[model samples]
Target: MGTPQTVLHVDDDPEMLALSTATFHQFDDISLLTATTAIDALDIVSSHSVDCVVSDSLMLPDGVPLIEALRRENKDVPIVLFTAKDWTEVADVASAAAVSEYVQKAGPDDLSTVLEHVGMLVDGDRDESLAAGVSAVTEALADHADAASAASFSLDENWELVGQWVGDDELGIVVVEAIEAHAGLPAIEEPLYDYIDADALEELLRPVLEDEERPGIEVRFPYGDFELAVTSTGDIFARPEPGETLY
Candidate 1:
């Protein structure tokens, strides 16, 4: 067996810490360490080998500050903000801080989501090839803003699609095509009826993209093993979802 992974969970609430400790006890391969303050968390990190850090957004120093400090100490250790805060509330700051994952805490079941991200991240299961493909697409979009009406890009072995966009059809084609490619079957052959409601997703995203009031807004969602992001400016990005084991 591999060396047991260590996770440091930071929260000011003693009860929450105790609950996390109890929850982690069921996993023999994981060791949980708790701290009530950012100082203590940093101290523990410096003294021990930590595979991942899970933190509450609202604490004495706040999650973003703690993340900054953690980055200074160790740039690559996975940091997950397991918070009750809405994604829109902390999205910009958290992204700037280079957070590995953001797991919203809505109820008891959310703890399992946190555990999944920690396990996947610590195991180094992220798809680097997929990330590279997404980066290349993003760069192409920036460089050729006025040149092309449509473009096609090939992903790694996992997925491929002819990415195209024009006028108000900002995200429709790319989102559907990407999801279909990821599923490895065309929509007609094996429709993801129960899995993803493509039309509904486009409707929800329409206002978000059309709203000039919120210019920098970006919408993100999980489709199969990939997390897809679409910006207001009609840019599409795809990366391996954090908690999934990408084959």
Candidate 2:
């Protein structure tokens, strides 16, 4: 058989690297390289061919942002952000950077799933084909709500929400109401609220009605069991805690 594909695992934590190495070892068709720093990992990438890079968002010693550093070396290389929480913050940056994938730094099983997807993509699997099977199902569910009508929120000068999204259902009305309530004024265009954050976005919501005439409200999402407080400046933001489930 040909040599196994190589996966570079980069993180500042030694235990995480060791655990990942042991986990991937179960698959005989894979080889792993562990790096404790972004510089060392970049060196490895320059010297050896790497199929995928599983990295942390933050590494020590100048604390190079993992995604930014990876983009400099290899833009096309598939990178997975292994993090504890703050999915919104990472997702926002990743989306802007067009990252390949992201997985929570929770369990070995989650890591395994991330590895499996990366391996398949690197091994010449079509992205659409791989995503189609699952994306279709998710899209179908998403069809339950109009994307145009999706909820939003108002933010403050610091981009913090003064309240939360409150409504009868998952429809965008909730988000609209939430923003309306916090802004104390009607949204410019649609009824739905807006999303804003400095690092991570924790809540998606509907603004409240008569926001200006009433006190700030706190909207809650039953799906993730998270809440948000919309501010008056039309910016809604949240700071995620480690180990918090975003989705």
Q: Pick the candidate with the highest lDDT.
A: 1
lDDT of 1 by residue, 1-247 (tens): 4567889999876535644664565455678899878889989999999989998874335544777777778888999998888999879768866899998977545665676677678775432322333333333333332221122132234322223222235345556675565455653243334446656655544221121332343455565566665544344556666666655
For model 2, residues 1-247, the per-residue Cα lDDT tens digits are 4567788888876535644554455455668898877788888988988888887876436755666777778878888777786788678667754677778865434655666576675675433333433333233223212221233323334333332322224434444454454445543253233433312222332222212232233333221222343332122334333355433
Report RMSD for candidate 1.
18.4
Model 2, CA-based lDDT: 0.52
lDDT of 1: 0.60
Cα TM-score of candidate 2: 0.47
Ten contiguous residues minimizing lDDT sum, candidate 2: 140-149
